[model samples]
Target: MAYSEKVIEHYTNPRNVGSFAKGEDNVGTGVVGAPECGDVMKLQLKINPENGVIEDAKFKTFGCGSAIASSSYVTELVKGKHIEEAMTIKNTVIVKELNLPPVKIHCSVLAEDAIKAAITDWKSHQTPASAQEPRKAQES
Candidate 1:
């Protein structure tokens, strides 16, 4: 299938296409695969702990042009966004922005899932006291 100009552009020059050092405390890494299509995606994010802003994002995807474009676009989209704001970015938005055809929509979904997985990993790494203190205060 033909790709949209945006997809072609992103695929041609994929952004943030590398990984952080292994065991980097500030970095969160997410890896996901599509068994049916044999696609694998690895996404990494570095976040500012104090304010929860995404400082950097990187992705390596093994799939079609749409998957690569989706991963690249998502990295651009999340950089500088607060974690909560980034979480609000839906797969449908990626699909629309990239002009992905219906058959290629799963690629966008994978991108969204990768983002969430990375964020979850980041959260998991945080100290429980630091991570839960704000929530406890809010509950009070």
Candidate 2:
């Protein structure tokens, strides 16, 4: 398969390659698979609690160059973005950014889903205790 120079570069010298410590509340990780291409991607993220911003991101994708590039690029895209902002990330953006071919576009979508899942998990955890409970007092 033909890959872009940038894709090759990233695949050879990928950034943020390792996983963060487990049970770390601020860290989010996503693993996705594509049956057609037999591609599997694992992307991780570290978000800042105070601001709910993505402080760092890493990936351990076991797929082709496009999958690797998508995850790598998403990690870089979300480095300084707040969860709300990051949630707005679209697969189209990734596709356009990488100029991904039609057959390889699914990989980019998986990368985007990974980011969304991480953000969603973070938002769910952020619900205040009061919001989680409706009754504050005991009934007599």
Candidate 3:
């Protein structure tokens, strides 16, 4: 099958491709795999607690072009954004931006899950006296 131009661009020149060698020992790691679809994605991130910003991201994906691109895009999206802002990023944004097909929508969900997992992992590392639970979604 032929990949879309966006997928081709990201897979060929993925951004934020490596680990932060000495990133926080508490780096958050999220792994999602869908056997039926033959896709597996692992997203890891290093976040700054003071600012709740993603400092670095690395991913290992096993799947088709859309899956690869979705993971790649999320990595780019989260960097430098406050954790809460990153969490607010919607799959619709990914879908619209990547122009993903209906059949591949789950790929965007996987990217969202990876972001949540990474943030949860970051929260887990906080000292007992300092751990801040992720705030709930506030409806407007």
lDDT tens digits, residue span 35-95, model 2: 8888887777788878777899988888889899888888899999988888889999988
Where is the poorest 10-residue window by lDDT in model 2?
131-140
lDDT of 1 by residue, 10-52 (tens): 9999999999886566777889888868889999999998999
What are the root-mean-square deviations of the candidates from the true structure over C-alphas? 6.2, 6.2, 6.9
Can you give the TM-score per candidate against the true fold? Answer: 0.89, 0.84, 0.82
Backbone clashes counted, model 2: 0
Please give the range of 10 consecutive residues that has the lowest summed lDDT in model 3. Answer: 131-140
Worst 10 residues of 1 by lDDT: 131-140
Poorly placed runs, candidate 1 (over 4 Å):
128-140
Global lDDT scores for all candidate models: 0.90, 0.79, 0.78
Candidate 3 Cα deviation (angstroms), residue 7: 1.1
Could you tell me how far off, in angstroms, the CA of residue 120 lies in candidate 1 after the best superposition? Answer: 0.2
